[model samples]
Target: MRTTETSSWMKQLTSSSRQGRHGHALHLFFTRLCLQPSIHGLVDPYPAAVPTALRACAHLANAASGRLIHALVLTRPALASDEVVATALLDMYAKCGIISSARKVFEEMHVRDLVVWNALLAGYARHGLPEHALVLAVKMRGLGLNPDRVTWNAAVSGFAMAGNDRMASDLVCAMQDDGFQPDVVTWTSLVSGSVLNFRYGRARMLFRQMVAGRAHVMPSSATVSSILPAFAGVSDIKHGKEVHGYAVVAGVEQEVTVSSALVDMYAKSGLVHEALRLFDKMSERSTVTWNSMIFGLANSGHCPEAVSLFDRMLREGVKPDHLTFTALLTACSYGGMVEIGKTLYRAMREECGIEPRLEHYACMVHLLGRAGKLDEAHDFIKAMPVEPDCFVWGALLGACRSHGNVELAELAASHVRTIEPSNAASYLLLSGALASAGKQNEVFKIKRSVKRRRVKRLDGCSWLETS
Candidate 1:
């Protein structure tokens, strides 16, 4: 029976090859070749066969098909003992987002291999369980199973994702001590992880190390994308340009993800013109690309240009999502484009079919308040479909400051105080508004209330760059 099954499986592979069905059809043929019961008790009933079927299930993402493959594996005696087949099971379950089942397979394996350990580590790492990945890595070491490059990458990446940079650095050091040369992935994680914690110094140091090393491990597109945000945070246009040059030399300048990051970097560094240049040269852009541009403009106080770009985005048939509305509303508030803001806010629900989130309402309050429509803005907040957050009340209080309406200021101030009683800015705004109205006694009352609460203003500091 085993011989007959081998002959049939060989014939199927041969027939599929000759008939020019060597792609999907061949995959299906191999899939069925694993499930025949005639060879169930063969010395190696389902090693290669089961792995191939598991690959098919991974491709199809059909849990039912995966379970069918597992059922076949269970029925075969020798097949269930193959570590390769078990790794496939772990991989299939992990890729299907069924981490629990993957863990069960791992725990049940009588003699788990390094590949099995790596699969579980990778599964937990990918599923945002870095702690679990770390614990598993420790267990794998305790069981005397030395980790390979892939396993090390999984463990390092897990710590990096969880913002545990100290552990990530320690892992890298340990890998180096073990004579494992860091690959592109390891370097990428170090740079990206450091930037995530705003540790630009460490990020740049590792980047320099990668460049200086003779191993020829070039940075990937993800590496460039990761480092770009660090430059943005520091407003370091000089370093940003240097990195951009490296990206150009590496021939990744036109990549949409990297280009989007570059645009954001340039914009945040107060170089909107450079950002626009990159935006125009980008061959392809996603919704995030448009969003970065809009948000960049809004943040830089180029509110009119930001609003104009939103219109152009619509004209170019790019649909505005929730972030687009938030950006547009910010532009409107900052630029005092009250009418345009109202129109955009209405069009959000009517034309775009995107529900206005709380941030959108906050923008409306800011817009109305900035326009001196305090009464209307207050009413709008009261009628909001969602509960008003601190930002909404903050906007109303700001409007009170602008209009010098003590009554409205106190009302807005009271609401903010209820939410954040110790906020110095809220109390200060209330006091100043009353004082501006010649209500000195009322101002003293607010100050007394502040004193009784022991609220103190936080000192504001500005940094001056030194050469």
Candidate 2:
């Protein structure tokens, strides 16, 4: 019943969609094909066409278009009952953040495959419903459906995401016992999960074990990138350099993610020169790459270098983002470029179209406060469109302490305490401010208050490398 032209169009669209070219052109083509009247009058779209359009909707996160496709499928019972079409619909809804709709589609499916189950499981994990995903995994096993690598990876990742690294590790072991060896994907999930749960030391150890245990399965660029943060956290330049060496030998140094992680690791480890060198040598750079280099330079006290790099990034036609502005503003704050900071703050909205986020406002507060503009900073906080957070107040308090402004310090400390009652930083800063101002009585009162709240100060520890 299909015309040759209609069949050709569907074939081309399906090919393009499979090749991951699911953009506006594909969306428009599909829409036109479905609406076009054929010799028989209303030509029902090919069953393959439905899944392709659904894929485009998933890629674009276009729920409205997906709903239209769903309606079309509903009118054609064959397409609705088709497993592939049903799976695509489920995936589209899941990706669009409509999990309830995806579940309904799954429940109504005439027959389900492993692919469909995995899709639903991944959807649950992606939406932060790890417990639901785990429960579903149990049900899958109860039906005698053995989990594949993808399923095991999802379960491990889900548990990891839930901050249960212990359970995640246990699951990994269980997966190995079930005759499924932990691959690079499995280890990567564990490493990233450990890092996310603040088990940096464990992440480092796992990275080591992964290299030693899995000789055949070499670490991917993602695996290398995941472990770099652990090195950065502890300033382990020795371990970081070793990872860098492996990245170079593995020919993944050109990968934007791996390169960026290497740059960030070196920069945070107090090797700004090395970080800059790596940044310069990168053949390709992403927005994240630029942000990392700029942030590194700014945080490492190379304020002038950071600003210079920002200018070059602009000259190279790389669009600046919020993080870009944050680094630039932070550099201005540290370097006492108050006028420049003010100009950039205004340009954030007017020029770059980036609305100031809380981090940007915090940096601005720090900028003004560091320049001894206590009154101006206070007025600025009061005039902010968004409510000032504890970081803003803490910045003001730090400035008050530096300038010996007892009254302003007290006001800032009160706001800090109200926002974060048990914040040791607030108590310590307030106590320091009062002590500096010779208010012995107030200092003693703060100490007693801290003790009464049982707020223990976190220890100040620094990473030291021995030659």
TM of each candidate vs. truth: 0.74, 0.87
The number of clashing residue pairs in each candidate reads: 0, 0
**Candidate 1, RMSD to the unseen true structure:** 7.4
User: Candidate 2 clashing pairs?
Assistant: none
lDDT of model 2, residue 338: 96
lDDT of 2 by residue, 1-467 (tens): 34887677777787788776788535656666657776455447767777888989999888988998898788777887899999999999988889999999999997888899988998887677888888988899999898888988888888886778888888888888888988988888888888877788888888888888654568999999998888884557778889899999999988889999998888887788998899999998878888888888888898888889988998999999999999899999999999989998999999999999989988999999999999999999999999899999999999999999999999999999999988999999989989998999989999999999998789888766553
Worst 10 residues of 1 by lDDT: 37-46
Where does candidate 2 have its weakest 10-residue lDDT segment? 34-43
Residue 271, model 2: Cα distance from true site in angstroms: 2.4
Candidate 2, lDDT over the whole model? 0.87
